[model samples]
Target: MGFLAGLALLLLGLHLIGEGLSSVKGKRYLLARAFSRPGSLLLSGLLLGLLSGSGTGLSLLALGLLEGGIFSLGQAALLSLAATAGAGAWVGVVALAQREVAEVLLALGLPLFLFRGSRSGGLVLLGLGLLFLGFLEMGQGAKAFAPLLSLLNPGPWALYLVGIVLAFFLGTANGVAALALALMPFLGQGGSMALTLPLIHIRRGGQRGS
Candidate 1:
């Protein structure tokens, strides 16, 4: 029950993450000017990933920028790199600060989502709130499943395969990483961590179709 609930919440959160950002596409255009310099483009991508917490979302944004001539293909590539870095950093931040972030988002998001117009970025706030909540729930599910799952040793390769599958399970790289950690606690601590990076990298490439 909890596992399914967590999965559903995660998927929904990711959907909102994509929609919320796309909703603010006009604002995202500002990032193109910020990307004028190589170093600044990377920094902009980093900040975008930090804010949106998803490389997939950042990639779509970059595509829009590229098509609109706001950025070159080379600059888009740089943006993708920085976006992944920022989103990777965000995973740790979310793990440690879930409670604080969740609380703030909820307090700010509920009313905004319900009353404020969609143009107000309410959906974005609500999506972030749900994203944090889903993480907390997923953590609980992991802890709950760990003990029962510990007995199963699927081996490193098999565990890694599972990690790859999970990484591709969600729209955002961060969500994929989170799901990888949540589902593979049976692989033991360091075992799962070892697989996460490669799995995320693979999924990012798949998402990029390159």
Candidate 2:
């Protein structure tokens, strides 16, 4: 029941986002102008990479903002790949440090499988459905570890480190952000500093619009 409700919310949110983006099609010219600048695409990529690495949804939102047909489909595709990769790497490292392979795959693969093929967006709906189910199973498993939580309670730094790993493997900037928020109260100063990553890029290049 709870999982169904959550899945419904996820679908609703995606619908609203798609609708909103479509409504703004008139602004394509302005975006074209901005995106056409020489360093603009790379800056956009950097902004996306940093935001993605930090676990914020800003990078994905950056992709949406650029989706005004200002940039070619190829450019947007590359940006999505880069942003997701950077974000995934950050989360993957953290996840491996905290948990086993099976847990990690359940956290990721289930969604990928569910959302594999769709004409418009059966993918989004199904993926969210799988994620909701996955998390519920996770929570059930978590109950067994309740006793361990008490042991780790005083050592909040330990949890924050674990939380960082949790965020990274999830492949969700939003998930990462939520985890960071939940764990922030428990974290010490030095713990927060560990979140930053060095510049994320090899060579971001594309044509500029005039």
Candidate 3:
């Protein structure tokens, strides 16, 4: 139930983010201008990935921008690379404090969402908060499977395959990473599995971008 709830929240958060971005005034023009320069595009992608904490989400966002004629293919590719890096960085920084950050975002976003002038910004913030909270809930729910995972001593190749499968189902590197971390202590080969999961998800994100 917790995992399912988390998945629902995660999807909802992504939806809200898309809605907020699409509704913002001059958003396309601002994005196009930012993507005009390689450095600025990379920075924008990194910041977006850090905020969204999902390379897959960034890849989809890039695709949407491409379809909207706001970005060239090359720019979109660059954005995906930078965004993946930023998402990895986010995992390292926020893995432990996700709940706190989510609470803070919720506190700030709710009031802003009620005001017409700041609706877009509010939606983005609320989406981010929900994303973080979803990750936390998923991690908690994953604890139930610890005993089952502990029974197997999987090799690196097996772990890689597992990571790929999990990434495919989760559709978000952040969620997979959270699950991996939750189950790490139970696995005898935790180190290799830990490294493989994020790499698999990153590859998946790259593929989606392409």
Best by lDDT: 3
| Residues 41-135 of candidate 2: C-alpha lDDT, one tens digit per residue | 55655544432243124334445655644567656655555555555454333332222433453354445445534212333333333333333
The list of candidate 1 runs beyond 4 A from truth reads 26-43, 72-78, 115-120, 183-186, 194-210
Clashing pairs in 3: none
lDDT of 1 by residue, 35-99 (tens): 68998888878876875777766777777888888788998888888887887687676566476
On residues 1-210, what C-alpha lDDT tens digit does candidate 3 reach at each position? 786677677667766765666573247677777679999989988887776666666777777888888888998888888887887776665456468889998899899899999998899889878877876776677667666556665666787777777677756666566556655655545554654565665676667656
| Candidate 3: segments with Cα more than 4 A from true spot | 1-15, 22-26, 34-38, 56-77, 151-162, 188-209
The per-prediction tally of clashing pairs is: 0, 4, 0
Specify the poorest-scoring 10-residue window by lDDT in model 3.
Answer: 187-196
How many clashes show up in model 3?
0
**Residue 58 lDDT in model 1?**
78
Candidate 2 has a TM-score of 0.34
RMSD of each: 3.3, 12.8, 4.0
Native-referenced Cα lDDT, model 2: 0.40
Ten residues in sequence with the least summed lDDT for candidate 1 = 164-173
